[model samples]
Target: MAPRLLLVEDDLHSRTAITLFLGDAGYAVDPCPDFASALRHLQNAQNDVPDYAAVLTDYNLGHRDLTGLSVCQAMRRTSNRKAPIIASSSEMKYWEEVADVFKLNLVPKLRHQWDGPAILAKLEEIGIKP
Candidate 1:
C-alpha cells in the first residue's frame, strides 16, 4: 500500500495542489483545511495508532491564534508521535521557531512554487521514502 500522509493547509489552492502532487507521487494524502480538522484526524487513531507516515502543515493556518506549529506540537502528543511532521510555509519567520525549538522539518513554500519536488526531497531526507 502507498504511504499515507496528513496534509494541513488552509488555502484551498495550496491544499488541492499539494494533494494532487503528492497523490501523483504515490502517497495517500488526507488533506485538512484547518487546525481542528487536522487534530481530529490525528486523534482518530486506528488500532490505537494513527496511520500517517508523515504530516505537512502550513505555518499560517488562517487563524489569528493558532498556526501549523500548533498542529505539529499536537501531533507529538498523539498516537502517531513517531511520524515525521513537516512545516511548509511561505512565512520564513517561523521556520526557525519550528525547526529549532520543536525539531520539525521545514519545506519553504515559495510563492508560485507549490510543485512537489522540495517536499518530496524533504520527505526522503527524513527517511520517508514517499
Candidate 2:
C-alpha cells in the first residue's frame, strides 16, 4: 500500500495542489482544511500506531488562536509520535523560533511557487520514502 500522509492546510488551493502532488508521487494523502478536522483524524486512530507515515501542516491556518504548531504538538501526544511532522509556512521567523524546540522540519512555502521539490527532499532527508 502507498504510505499515508496527513496534510493540514487551510488554503483550498494549497491543499488541493499538495494533495495532488503527493498523490502523484505515490502517497495516499488525507487532506484537512483546518485544525479541527486534522485533530479528529489524529484522535480517531484505531491502534497505537499512526495512520499516516508523515504529516505536513501549514503554520498559518487562517486562525489567530491556533496554527500548525498546535497540530504538531497534538500529534506529538498521540500514537503518531514516531511519524515525521513537517511544518510549512511563509512565516519563517515564527517557525524558526519553535521548530527546533518542537523537533519539526520547516519547509518554507514560497509565495506563488509550488514547493514540491523541497517538501519531497525533506521527506527523504527524514527517511520517509516516497
How do the residues 74-129 of candidate 2 rate in per-residue lDDT, one tens digit apiece?
Answer: 88888777778888888777778897778888888889333898988888898887
Q: What is the lDDT of residue 16 in candidate 1?
A: 97
Worst 10 residues of 2 by lDDT: 43-52
Provide TM-scores for the models.
Answer: 0.91, 0.92
Q: What is the lDDT of residue 37 in candidate 2?
A: 93
Count residue pairs with overlapping backbones in model 2. Answer: 0
Looking at candidate 1, what is the lDDT of residue 54?
A: 91
Q: RMSD, each candidate, Å?
A: 1.7, 1.7
Q: What lDDT tens digits, residue by residue, belong to model 1 across residues 1-130?
A: 8888999999999899999999998888999999999998998854465479998888889998888888888888887787888877777678676487777787788783454899999888888875
